[model samples]
Target: MLIKECKGFELEKEKSNTSEDFFNRSEVTFIENGEEKTLHVLYVRYFDEILQEFTPYSQDPILADQGLDVTFKDIVALVCLLKNPGLRGRKRLYINSKHDFAAYFQDIDFSKLPEVFQSLKQKNSYELRSPLEFILQPK
Candidate 1:
């Protein structure tokens, strides 16, 4: 769906890229079940200045289709987890797409973490890592 139809997220411009055509960007947002939401997200690339015609220019509209992609910083930690799990911070892959949510149910046992979507604010006993723990937690 077009961002204009969605309820969350704002259009922004990238100031660092001095080039006129490439300066537009937006802080990534996600849509779940046709609605927008997030939880404890610390996305930092949002533009302070709004780009009048840029259309959330950081990511092309297609990204909104595949859902939010794994970020650079997130990728770094993911790879590190494979090499060394001891140093990585408490990581959670919050589900922001339909595919992720479906994939979650297909791969995991219902008894381990039973909620279809659990917000981060709710404290739970599943914080312990299993070499690498990935949850389909939601916003």
Candidate 2:
């Protein structure tokens, strides 16, 4: 019954986090209610515009679920990125699976995304390396 805003949350991607035990053991620090708290955010959800709802691919979002990885920031970003043309149009970016690319695309610059994705276009059944793959990939 409590909803609060996260002031900001930044992951230092360049540095490998030894604490990250894959997704199951990852955690992030964020600001909420004027105080800092670390939450275990791990669930994946996609925005369903047709149904006008949020579809959770994981367990239900409840405080009792200590292992749940879902977070408001992640859900918001996924919805925002899916709304952009860069991730959806002709110069589309194909994610082999959710594990390949998740909600991180929303944090990147949308204006430059379309251009970067152009390099990813496949040729003769072999996909080319994209500058975006390095950029958008989650650490």
Candidate No. with top TM-score:
1
Clashes of 2: 4
User: Which segments of model 2 are wrong by more than 4 Å?
Assistant: 1-23, 43-101, 107-139
Task: Give the per-residue lDDT of model 1 (tens digit) for 1-139.
Answer: 1111111232244475544332222222233346543222222222213211222234322122223332222221222232243322333333334343233233222232222112111332113235223332444
- Note the Cα lDDT for every prediction shown: 0.27, 0.30
**lDDT score at residue 76, model 2, on the 0-100 scale:** 34
Q: What would the per-residue lDDT of candidate 2 be over residues 1-139, giving only the tens digit for each residue? A: 0112211123333457553222221232333345543333332223212112223233322112333333333333223333342432122232323533444433443343223223222211112133343234466
RMSD of each: 15.0, 18.4
Estimate the TM-score of every prediction.
0.21, 0.20
What pairs collide in candidate 1? 25-58
The true-versus-predicted C-alpha distance at residue 38 of model 1, in Å, is: 17
TM-score of 2: 0.20
